[model samples]
Target: MRPSIKILEEDMKEKVVLEAMEILEEIGFFVENTEAVEILRNAGINVDSETQRALIPADLVKKSLKTAPQSISLYNRDGDFVTVLGGDNICFDPGSAALNVLDQETNEIRTAVTKDFVDFTKVVDQLEHIQAQSTAITCSDVPEKISDRYRLLIALIFSKKPIVTGTFVKESFEVMKDMLVAVRGSEEELRRKPLAIFDACPSPPLKWSDLTCQSIIDCAKYGIPSEFVSMPMTGATAPVTILGSIVQHAAETLAGLVITQIVSPGAPVIWGGSPAAFDMRKGTMYLASVDTILMDLGYVEIGKYLNLPTHAYLGMSDAKILDTQAGFETGMGSLLAGIKGVNMISGAGMMNFESTQSIQKVVIDNEIAGMTYKFVKGITQRDEPIAKNLLKEFDKKTHLLSHDHTMKWFREELYLPSTVVDRSTNEEWITKGRKSIGERANETVTKLLSKYPGVSLDNDIIEDLTRIMKYENVDFKTKLDL
Candidate 1:
């Protein structure tokens, strides 16, 4: 049997969902977008024109849930099927929208530039365990107006994996969609095989900004998957209790779902969030806190209970550096998320409360992801008689090292991590210069970049991408030659 975890009981999940529907019916959500207001007004829901408060009835929410797809299929840039974001199938990608990167040479956090993002994309492309790439960081070198689509452009040029990306402004979505269409050759094909999932976050305490609401609607109209990232900080923007925060998250996510399904009856959406456990002493929000991880797992359970694809900001650290705290927190969160089988597990290279990205931490997290994948496979009975036949063959004089059984199962049973992980003896370590994990990861990063067979897109496609970006912002200067 596959290993799994569920924090919310069956009855509790029902209760949580019911409370969320009731909250939407009674308290309502503040919908800032005029188009979204009209959509709700046409859907026969009560909308206050002055306040822009959309009172979505429970029946509408239930109907929206019925229309929203349970699974979303994501494809690589080359139009090949990659993975599905539903059920117990889990996929990992680096977190999105980090402002800073841990500089390997200086070992200090600094603003990320185009080069930093390119190197990050290269590393993510080679990681065996990470299934997708993200617009992981914003480029300081580029103009902020085009930053959202600019990141997507770079990912399209360098990596072949499907991206987990989003927009900062309402107008950016059309340009971003045009870029994806350029890669896929047409709008219909791009919609048929979605190349990316856009993240649309709802403001806390039942609020959807005009930009995010527009993003949700645009994604729905184009048949692109929209991931609802509901961030509710405990004891701060949301209620102090974990269950209370989850109720708020459910309400906010349901509101987005209603808007998406209303726009396009069969549009895809994932039930995802990045909720935080507030530390009152320092007034800091901890992404890696046990409380926060529990909240993520709880909401994922609720999503599963609702039979929807789920996502969470787990497998990341809040620590300032890649120290013991980083390892402990990243390992715990990743293993738990893997065990729970969250569909799209984000936050592989993220740190410092998800404000920073570390390529080295990403290299190490690849191994963690590998191990977690193995752990969730559980113990398999490889032989017919279980261990009896193998045990019968064991003798004092003859060990299993030279046996055929060992040769057959060792490779599959054991998860041999990359050289980034140190398993050498003390004497071997001394001979090999005793490099730290960060140092080892840095070396791996160098090796991967050196051997990276650069993606070769047709000249016409390259010109099209560049033309799209240049059209958006005439002054946009890129580190890429194109």
Candidate 2:
């Protein structure tokens, strides 16, 4: 889409960049970590000798960002389904941590499980706009020892799209490395068309975790696009103000960029966050508050200053129950963030502090993502006569099935809904027992997985991937593993 489709206009962008430079110069980020400080200084940022407060030259930030190649690709055994190389294309992905009550049999709302993850992945893989899958699905059943990559392994089986995931520990890094190798067929293939991974750092004063830093370094070396998602909870985690949260997010992200870029100058990175504020009344953190949305918008604006792609954690709710609040929170957040051109907006399909994930919400949120894509494209005027002449050619007696125009328009204009909004007539619904969204979603997941084998993967590559998944402790050791 070039800079034209950029969320920030030229004059607007320049002004923002200039102001950010000053903010960095005057206030400076509280980056005490020597690695981060030195990297910023080496990159020609002006750092205060004692405090390590720094201001990066706008030119350097732009240049470094420009080096991040506009596009990145991830492949399945079949081939690349998502290549975020910059286009009019915008799609929604999975939310992290499904901690709500998914299995009604249990009746208690809690964390998601390994099987729950597999089920959720199937529903997402079935989605159209969710071009990449985030193994944000949680595996609550697995021992903590294997929980991190456990969901990722389930995702690997179900998704052909690139899976966005995190490494909570050093060993999970190997699991991810091997997972990509399985998808790419070999280390050489992985290096050639790297998988995109989003990594996060705890916000300022706090440093990148030992596991996360190690993972970033490991990911950079392999050419995978590992982005930094710095989450700062204002009021609770930061200063309880949106502006304060933005700076903290900026500091954390830039520090990550320093390390990642140093590890590999163009180690494909995105500026992203999960920052939000706590609700004082309820004593809970609201993931979809106006403060959260606005702060995220501000962060993306800052990323535009650096000329990098962006990401944010929106579309999540603080609502404890899965109801209208969950839907509206997800929809509104998705709309603005998508309109603002967030490269990726994580946190969908969940309720309660992002600790729980749900298939029902995943399906519904994906539909929202599809709707958001429509908004981002806005409405374009086509020069063609599907404009007028085709409409005139429409005949009342003829069925649309026989009309070429129907096919043309349907392919271009249709935004199909997932299992969210009920589409059946009352009579039809009655006959079908008025199924809940969850019931339909559960059915949809089974249908997709049943259809998976018919959608083929290369046999030799599949064999190699099987070995890697097994070797990396990601399951799929058996010949029957899907």
Model 1: per-residue Cα lDDT over 58-130, one tens digit each: 9999999999899999999889999998999999999899999999788899999989998899889999999
The TM-score values for the models, in the order shown, are 0.98, 0.80
Off by over 4 Å in 2: 1-63, 85-88, 97-101, 104-107, 382-411, 418-420, 425-431, 454-482
State the displacement of the C-alpha of residue 330, model 2, in Å, after optimal TM-score superposition.
1.3
What lDDT does each candidate get? 0.92, 0.66
Candidate 2 residue lDDT tens string, 329-393: 88888888777777777777766776776666666677788888776765554547536765565
The lDDT, on a scale of 0 to 1, for candidate 2 is 0.66
Of candidate 1, the 10-residue stretch with the lowest lDDT total is 472-481
lDDT score of residue 18 within candidate 1? 96
Best by lDDT: 1
Question: Could you tell me which residue pairs clash in candidate 1?
Answer: none
